[model samples]
Target: MLTYYMPPKTMWSNLSKETLRIYLDQAQQAYNDLLIGNKPISVSYSQETGAKSVTYTQANLQQLQGYILELQRTLGINRRRAMRIRFR
Candidate 1:
């Protein structure tokens, strides 16, 4: 089975932008999979001295979303909708 690694959030700024982009892509793909009824998504990440695997469930959907947003923000690629209002 192929596995993807998620770098620690604290290390995001230090990672090369290319690496960060790869991570962001992985995160977004996982999030999309979960949204379409995929369950128990697995992601690996380094913790302390070793790598650990985390399984994300439907219950953790929001948390996954937060990760996506955080990554997007870090990459400065988050899409923000602009609104305009006019009153006469």
Candidate 2:
């Protein structure tokens, strides 16, 4: 028999269930930027102030991905979505 030790609730008490999903979505968009067939995530446009701006969502891609992975592990969130696909 195998037994898994569950972490105390306090360890993950502050982690939101939606945190990983939100980050995953943002990160996926960023990840696709490098794919040949997929559309890029970055865009250039002007703000209301008429200033040119570049919108590159991937700027925090690394940080988002890291937090997502960490929250997934800490919250055991991946175990429940083994074959689930969610779109928003």
Candidate 3:
């Protein structure tokens, strides 16, 4: 007779199915928020290689907030959730 069997338990087995599902859902949402909401806009810029070279821009709080707002609207996610992913 064949002795085909499954593997031993894993760490994830410690968590209830419902709890694991919720955690997975939250994690997926957080990742989606990051992809859609985290964008860097030009808050400042300076030329390092003279005017003929490409410009380098700085990112700051103001540009981050503006982009977050735009992303929230576009993604249909709440401001808090977007901010959580950004700050986390």
Looking at candidate 2, the ten consecutive residues that score lowest on lDDT are 39-48
Against the true structure, candidate 1 has what lDDT?
0.74
lDDT (C-alpha) at residue 34 in model 1:
90
Tell me the number of clashing residue pairs for each predicted model. Answer: 0, 0, 0
Winner of 1 and 3 under lDDT:
1
- Please provide, for model 1 over 40-77, each residue's C-alpha lDDT reduced to its tens digit, 9 standing for 90 to 100: 78866553467767778899998888887887877767
Best by lDDT: 1
C-alpha TM-scores of all predictions? 0.67, 0.34, 0.33
Ranking by TM-score: 1, 2, 3
lDDT of 3 by residue, 1-88 (tens): 8753332354344445554445445434444444565432112212333322221123344434444344333333452322444554
Model 2 lDDT tens row, 1-88: 9867564464334546575355446545555663434433543323244634333443555654664466566656555424778999
Candidate 1 vs 3: which has more TM-score? 1
TM-score of 2: 0.34
